[model samples]
Target chain A: MKRKQVLVRIFSLLVMLSMLAACTPAAAPTAAPAAEQPAAAEPFEIAVVVKITGIPWFNVVETGVDRAAKELGVNAYQTGPAQADPAQQVKIVEDLIAKGVDAIAVVPNDAKALEPAFQKAKEKGIIVITHESPDQVGTDYDFELIDNVKFGQHAWDQLVKHMGDTGEYAIFVGGLTVPLHNFWADTGIEYAKTKYPNLKLVTERIPCGEDQELARQKTLELIKAYPDLKGIVGFGSLGPIGAAQALKEKGLTDKIAVVGTVIPSQAAPYLKEGSMKEGLLWNPADAGYGMVWLAKYLLEGNKITDGMEIPGMGKATLDGTLVKLDLIMDINAENAESLGF
Target chain B: MKTLLRRHEAYVLLIIIVVSIIITAVNPSFFSLENLFDLLKSMSLMGVFAIGMLFVLISGGIDLSFTAIATVSGYAVALALLRYGDSLNIFVIFLLAGAIGILLGAFNAAIIYFFRIPSIITTIATSNVFYGILTVLSEGKWLYGFPTWFGDFANIRLFTLYSPAGNPYGLSIVTVIWLALVLLAWFILRYTVLGRSIYAMGGSPSSAERAGFNLLRLNLFVYAFIGLMAGFGSVIQALLVQTVAPNSLVGKEMDVIAAVVLGGASLAGGTGSIMGTVLGVALITLLGNGLTLMHVPSQWYDVVIGLVILVSVGVSAYRMRKNIQRRVITETA
Candidate 1:
């Protein structure tokens, strides 16, 4: 056993060294066939680094991105961890730099962890764009595709519309550590404080850790904790469904209106059953499509000016190189039945 | 037949039946066919790892680095496809992953044999180093989009034995592969000369050395075997779910160890069986799934798991004590 341990240590060290060797210098294609394309065209590579891969949510988005890429004839690839881990996202960015991908589109797992990697990518002349979770935007990532600030405002707007202006409300969110969810909560609270001063947010926040079961448990606990709560705002896919189930089980379904950003399909039963009022979501597929379009548009020396619309993607206004797609929300009950899961 | 019923395995079976009966009375869904099958399927993966780890324990050795090795294989396969683009075939990815596993196992064996380091200490260090390397290489991103072959193979059915929910969903090719590996491992342990030598060494390394057992070579092979299993475990895990989250089973080594201990495997060398580990895995999975259905909070599941381990280990210890006392009285008389 001792012998085995020593052997592992030495071999792991060697692997580490080899990994470092493969990390940098080879990040970029030494010579992307610049001549193969028209003389005016510049060849480039774009890397879409997701939080993880092999799931329908992110994969469908990647599929849309590939559609945009194929239509535009630009080179792009999607990569991410198999599970959601921020620390791993940081390393992926670094590896992307070593691979010399021309631009990087990241759905940041962590805001801070990828800051250094994003800066490094920028230093290497890589365009860094973010989608959905823009936690690392304007720091590690050059720009965010989604207007998170607007997203937060949109969530509050929907909640207000669902519950009417004056009511006691509570928030069911993903992990507290998830920057986008945290920001959405913060903005939602701020909107409540400034705009609807009469609306009281129930004591404490519900963090479900992104698990449906835990979210349901938290919602049950919250119902017990605050029976007077008239509205619930969920900031994740499972949170709304979990909260709705909790509300229904407690016979408070009609008493409390549930609203938030969730996948329409996942929230359909809750909506149709009248357990929840509605849920909002940006089209992840379109978001991915726009990201690929933006990467290709910029790589072609297409000029980074504001209000330039790339083909296949609707008119996108660029603030420098960051393209922000207008928010598209999916309302449950009214609009969720037809939505794909 | 009566003696077989009196065996530790039968005792465990009785305990499961009795305990689960009580649990089901509280939450009837806990006994549902869907739930039971899911529990078995989910627990089987952990069982496979625990069974492999059982060999190490009976030999008075440990492999903390198994988790790290698994993570590396998972990440490497995913990264290879993305980095190499279409240059490498998907089949090559599995081969590369397996080769890497074997190499890692060999390295573990060689180091422990040559350095005379304690198995626990050495493996812990290697685990950290191995995980660190994987962390740096992956940069915190998961690798996805393996060819459909991965998930498709996992969905294949074999008779009425498979279901498609968690582990219960289908006769997952990965599950079958792991079972085969476990059976082969069991055979090697019970029937082979080298296998018996390992047990002898575990019983008393000094005595085994005096008796001309090649401790270094045996230790090396044993560690390598463990490493190989860890690698295979990761592959199955990746294929089982078709994704390798860098932190997929973070801190899962404890669960595997718990299963082994629960299965009546002694921490002290030379006293465990592959069959015992399987039972242990089933028990742990059933408890977890049953509790979840009972509306027990997900956060509390780990705590329940810990308690189950303690209770099961206590029972095994009590039975072992009685056996030892009986032997002593018989010898004295």
Candidate 2:
């Protein structure tokens, strides 16, 4: 009975300690505005949450958030789950709500999974701005850097040009479930079918699981399987990089063309060598910067009307709380280094 | 010849051949020399880990921490390379990685030996700890920007074969290292006193102790040895890719475990061979490679691998039952 009492005490102590720890970070942000701004009004505290932290894509996005924070004088910071798990992301959002941030901007891994937490944040009067997740509900606005159909058509045009308008081409996406990636793949294939009659897809879109090695191995096998394959359209950032590496190693760069939504830094060497012919992506930093800008715009009683200029993101079109922008950056050897991401 | 046919390694070898033949029949490009070399090169990394896993399995312990050891050791090497720059000797980086691996391996061994906790559970916990430390230290960032020599290391081809189109292909130095490790492991397991003790321990711990084998020393050595192999595997992987992602290798412990188990190594303990492990690695690698060559959807690959494991285990169980029945009949006679 004495041992049992001790165990109960210890368990309760642990519970208390964890609650304190959770409250500590939440408390620190609140204290910051009070301590720093004694004379002026409290700065808008905007928290930008991404799908995952510590990846190169989101790392670039964080830089944008930092840039916007500096420029706008808002207490803006970015946080996300370590892994791309929707449940973890929702937890972060809930914690942010508890901390009483004025606004929450998120890029969700799963749109439906995050709706409940987002709904809670909305109930607490927290302004919610999301990027890259158009289907996300319970948000004041969800912003997209590129129009899905337009981007798909653009990628198809580039692939057609490279393939001389005819050959067996393969398509790869980050995963079967990533909605945006699949949208791009679907529209790209549809556009190709209508616009370029000669080009053919070798197989249904293969999923890379966002892994570079998996992409590389799949590309290697694809090359072996289809000797006359002329082009590859990669829908994820790492897909083209992996395909290019495989093609470069086999000395098939001259024979085949590869294009994808790849980071400029990773695709630079491949682009220069003609292994990777083109890369299509919007500036992630811009998207990151834009989320905060949109959040602050809504917080200050601004309406997201069509053609209204967002500071970081240029002209935006409003479609039922979804702000879409056409900001695709065409990456090639000539301008790869200048982009820096 | 009949006995050879009945051996597990022989069955695995036959599977490899059959898979290759079918894949080649569908796509002749799969039978090319360059493709074979590519498949072997990819298999070398997992092949190295399987050797270490073989030791642990034979000693009646399962290690889930080998990949974690590889990640931390590789991260340490990457840090060393960054700190020392061009002036640092490459060999020293490898030695540092090996040392870190030994320390981590010792930690796992000490816990399992001292507390008598199940090795699987201990390794699972230790893997998380090792990976957590690595993530905290590196911030889950990828390490790149190695010296020219590091990049050059990956391109060091020995006995090159050139295609008619002038594309060079051959075995790499890393693959050579992998081959050497396999030979060394085979020698130790087949011909050494320590190896016999490990098998004895796995077969029955109390009897091994009665036979005067030091269980604690053997356990420590086996785990540490696996760690050492992990360290070497990490260095090879770093050299192979020329960029190290800390998180990329953590989830691959499953592949190593799968390969070891598929090699006819009984998870319950004691029976495995270096040759069987090599064949197992080759079969798994070829399955992935061949499926891709056949334009098989990537989603189906996981299902296929799961089915293959189930079937292979079933075959082994059936063979064991038959062997036992034969022994019983002879004893009755």
Candidate 3:
């Protein structure tokens, strides 16, 4: 009788440990299917793969994804590469698929490298969605959320409207080889050629490689290279923030205007300082939320038609292989104060 | 299989050649002299680190901390320039980076020697400490904007040689420096008693000790030597890239290990060639470039690299087993 009690205690301890081990930071996307589903329906599981973990951008997106998962009565998991590693991300997707996750969404480190993982997931009858901008999308990724070419053209149009379409301009790119950033740059350059033919691109390309200090250095170089440069277009999040710092350091806030894709909060302080004119970004939080909703909806045996009305997000349309969100957000000094941190 | 195993670099070279053909088939411009020069220029950075690591491995020790030390010291030099803002010479930064690398190496050696910790653990811990130091120094930010003089090595090429149609074909000064280091290392390993001792000790430390060798001293000496080489290599890499991201060389230890193993180093202790190590690094860089160019899809690069690693280890294991079986048979006879 005493041995039986001891065995029971040990078994209970093992169960507790296993539960603790399973309670990872990544919330499982396969729990609690909506009550509206048939009694026999199982919950859907989805994996959210980001560039790297422990960043504010990814953290916020995780929160939105988790919230959607909870609201829609599904399980969601948020995991990423320890660093921005394509190889690691591929491994994560493989693991997720092996574990029988319903779908996998990724913010790719390299577009071309991730195609096989996505293709394998599709072969397993799993949904593979990418949140890359159109310009940055690799031929391998099934589809991207936003068209980067349109994003670049739109950004340039806004910059033209801000700077009156006829002035010298420069670009602060993350890296010369970062495909997405290069796409934005190419499109911006094309726009410059077509619309503002006289706007000379100073130093050809400003590749900061996502280093804020390098971005600042490149910005200073731009200032020195084109003394009368009127506007700057930054490709990634860091480029504009770094450019803002360079402008502030040189006291050229009023002299040069800045614009790019970055967090509104990061751009707000600079916007307030008048070193940065404005910034643009898609609703990454909503994008995260949308992924969870889609994962759950598809898992519930709801077929993915061209026009799918989500619970609260209204109708989302699929343009061929692409899912269009039209989720762009523009931030300027006037309204930057109101955006959530 | 036997032929391929004997000439591992040939296998790698074939992969490179195959990849080049595919890339040229897709985008002919990728096969240009300029692109090849660019490939050489970029690869020389890791080439320097690989060469130093080759020495450490030949001596039966691993310096997993070298890249981190290089990055931390490189950033220190960057910060010093930022703090001094124009009073610093480009040469001074290189000196400072070297000093940091040497000090870091000595510190790692001292810990392993005194504490009797496994060299692997010591280096792994030091890797974290070094990376942490960089984070503290930069506060998770990056340091950039060195003067043109600091990065002049990136631009200078041997008398602007070009292809017949006038494309840039000459190698960068950095590649020339790396190749010189490789040659210098080759000579030392071939001629020097200390170099031979390193290999002997690696092959069998217990036998080396029985033969009147100082195990502790040699361990310290070898690791320190690797550190010094790593320091200089880091500066070259930093200068060539013209930027130092705090986390730039993270996880590159795996690449270093892969290169060494590919060069035919027995991780069980001794038996690797410096020439093989060079080929190993070249093959890896080539594989990366080739896979990307081939449009085999990005995900396949990892698969390809993983397969190469598996095959290399498997070949080594099979050869070792065959040798053991032969020795057993000879003794029985």
List, for all models, the DockQ compared with the true complex.
Answer: 0.06, 0.23, 0.02
List ranges where model 2 is wrong by over 4 Å.
A1-46, A69-75, A86-102, A115-127, B1-6, B83-85, B88-90, B164-166, B321-333
Clashing pairs in 2: none
lDDT of 3 at A122: 73
Q: Which of candidates 1 and 2 is the stronger one according to DockQ?
A: 2
Model 1 spans > 4 angstroms off: A1-341, B1-7, B26-33, B81-94, B159-169, B321-333
The TM-score values for the models, in the order shown, are 0.56, 0.87, 0.57
Q: Please give, for residues B1-333, the per-residue lDDT of candidate 3 as tens digits.
A: 234334655554565577568767765655666556656765686777887787777676667788778877777776776678567775677678778887888898899878977666677778767776555445344455566566554557885665443334467787887888788888877788777787888777789889988877777777876776777776775665445566666556777878877777655455666677777777777666655444344336567888877776577556656766776799999
Q: For candidate 2 chain A, which ten residues in a row score worst on lDDT?
A: A24-33
lDDT of 2 by residue, B1-333 (tens): 125323888888888888889998888889999898888888889999999999998787888789889999998888777777687776787788788888889899999999998787688778867776666667667776677677677767898897665667798787888999999998888799988789889877889999899999999899998999999998888887666777668668767877887888766566788888998899889998888887787778888887887787679757866776777799999
Model 1: share of true interface contacts reproduced: 0.01
lDDT of 2 by residue, A222-266 (tens): 877877899999987778877887787777898889988987877
Candidate number with greatest lDDT: 2
DockQ of 2: 0.23
| Model 1 DockQ vs. reference | 0.06
Residue B303 shift from truth in candidate 3, angstroms: 1.9
Task: State each model's CA lDDT, in order.
Answer: 0.67, 0.81, 0.67
Q: Which DockQ-derived CAPRI band holds candidate 1?
A: incorrect
Ranking by lDDT: 2, 3, 1
Tens-place lDDT per residue, model 1, B1-333, is: 124313767666776887688777866646555444445445656866786688788787777778878788878776775567466654576677767777887787777778987677677667767776666555445555565455455555463442222222334455567678888988998899988888888777889999999998888778777767776677667655454656555457877887886776655566677877888787877775555455454457668878877776777666666666777799999
